[model samples]
Every structure is written in C-alpha cells, then in structure tokens.
Target: MEQPPVTPRSALHTRPKSQGCFLVGKSLKPVVAPIYKKNGIFYAEIFLNWSHIVGERYSRLCRPVRITGDKPNATLYVGASRAVAAEMFYSVPTLLERIHHYFGFQILESMRFVNDFSSPHMASTFSPKKEEAAPQNSEEADASWKGDDITYPPLREALMRFQSYMRKIK
Candidate 1:
C-alpha cells in the first residue's frame, strides 16, 4: 500500500476539530468593503434608513440613487421629476447640510439631480394599512361592563389600558 500525498482539501478535511477555521463578521469586511467603496457609500445602514436621513417632506419627492467619487465631498445622485427638479436644485445647499448632519460628517458636496419621468409616482395622500382588531374575549367583555359603571375618567382610562394590554398578550 502507498501513502497518499496530503492536499489542501484533504488537509482541511483531516484537520482536528480544535484547529478548524470559521469566519466572523469582520472577515466579510474585505468582500463588502470594495462594493461600498466603489459606490462611494460610507455605510449600508443609510440606505436602510433612507427615509430618516432625508426628512419626511423630501423623502418622496426625491431619492438618493448612488454616491460618486472617493472624496469626502462625493456627488450624490438624486432621482426626481422635472416638476420638482428646479425646486430641489435651489434647496441643494440645505439638503447637503442635512445629509452631512445625518452621517455626522461631510459625505456629499453636490447633488446630481436626474429627472426620471418613468419612476413610479409617490401618492400625495398616505393611508396606512389598518390593523385587524382583536376579537373580544369573555374577560374583555366583562371588563367593559365594569368600566361602563365607573364614570371616573382616570379609572376608565386605566381599565382601557389594562384591556389593551391583555388583548396584546392573548
């Protein structure tokens, strides 16, 4: 019988449990750093919290597409409609300040406003989805009757709060 030469794969497979390797969150930095750096994004968290970075008023009117350039003063590409493009341009200075404040540093120096007519229009009126009301249990029904007897506003409020809390747990 001949002994086989140890290969990298075989070595890795035969490695002892104590010597095994595992990748942590920091290990992924090398792979993820290039993507953000290429797009000039300082942090991925900003994209997830986009609405907060840009105030509620401007959140729908415009959206940040991407950041360009490696400088601290990178160009922020914004998608908007022709109707608001001029208005948005005039507010660029204020917008820049807001963005800087958001990141706690100067991440953008200028805005490249792109008029995108095809982009979906944001509705002027917002109607949030109504949460389904929980069914009334016997305990809640009994509590309601007791609450009705008490005309004291403070006591009634406390009862209502208790009922709501019970409903959530149930």
Candidate 2:
C-alpha cells in the first residue's frame, strides 16, 4: 500500500496576528477592532451604552474618555469633575473589578480619572441645583456662597450672584 505524503507545518504560510479580518479594510480595523480583540468588548457600544459600564450615578459625574493601548493592563481614561474625581479615587479598585468582570477579562488594570472641570457636562453634574431654597435675604445668600463646590470660580460666582439678584427681584 502507498503512504500518503504528510504536509509539513513549516511550509504553510502563517498569517500575521496583527492582520485583521479580510472582510474589514485596514483603515477601519484600528477604529473598530481594538474594542473587541483587545478588551473583548463591543466597540461602538462602549460609547453608546456608557451608562451601563459605570452606572447611572457616575455616568453623569464622569465619562470614559478613551482606552489606551492593547495590553491586558490598558489604561482607561475617565473624564470627571474635580468634585467627583475624589470619590472615584477610593472606588478605583471596585470600579476596575466591575469593569474586568463586565468584559470577562482584566482588560483595564487601572483607571485614570482626570479632573476636567472645564467639561460643560461635568459642571452640570457637580453644580448645586437651582431648586435649592432661595436665600431669605442678600446677607444669607452672600454668606452661603462658598467656593468649595465651585467648578469654575469666576463663572460659578457670577452665576451665583445672578441667581441671588434674581431672587431679590422676585
């Protein structure tokens, strides 16, 4: 009986690991592939359904700015207000654990929460609501105006003064 020739593995051309699916263009791969291949996450959905990742409480105070690198310990940049940034500091471990569990891998070893008070959304999240009891008098208003919660010193002060003036007028 004649023996069939065995194919040698060395002769077979191996595709480069970086080479993305043939169906997707090279240009689109960088934009679309990393989320899935690197983090085992849905790319567009990360931004589209961001609240699902960080939860409703943090979603308003913070937002995922970007994911850097393709390593297992990739850094996830989260934009947050200075006020809420402190809260996130203590919750980093819990958040990372939740994110890892959500992605089914430790795709992010750490999160970098940048205190970006300049973000319009950040101010809205941390700012005191206008519904708070209007000051009984200008004296009380001026005394109550503290700089502690101010995201933008000038802007917040101006707005507070304006609100106080409006209350006086009414």
The per-residue C-alpha lDDT of model 2 at residue 158 equals: 91
Error of 2 at 80 (Å): 0.6
lDDT of 2 by residue, 1-170 (tens): 99989878866777656754566466777886755675555434556777787687767777877878765767878887776788778988977787767767666667898877655465655676668788998779778866568798898889878877777886
Worst 10 residues of 1 by lDDT: 118-127
TM-scores of all models?
0.50, 0.48
RMSD over all Cα atoms, model 2: 16.9
- The alpha-carbon lDDT assigned to residue 125 of candidate 1 equals 29
lDDT for 150 (candidate 1): 79
Which 10-residue window of candidate 2 scores lowest in summed lDDT?
38-47
Question: Could you tally the backbone clashes for each prediction?
Answer: 0, 0
Off by over 4 Å in 2: 1-44, 118-170
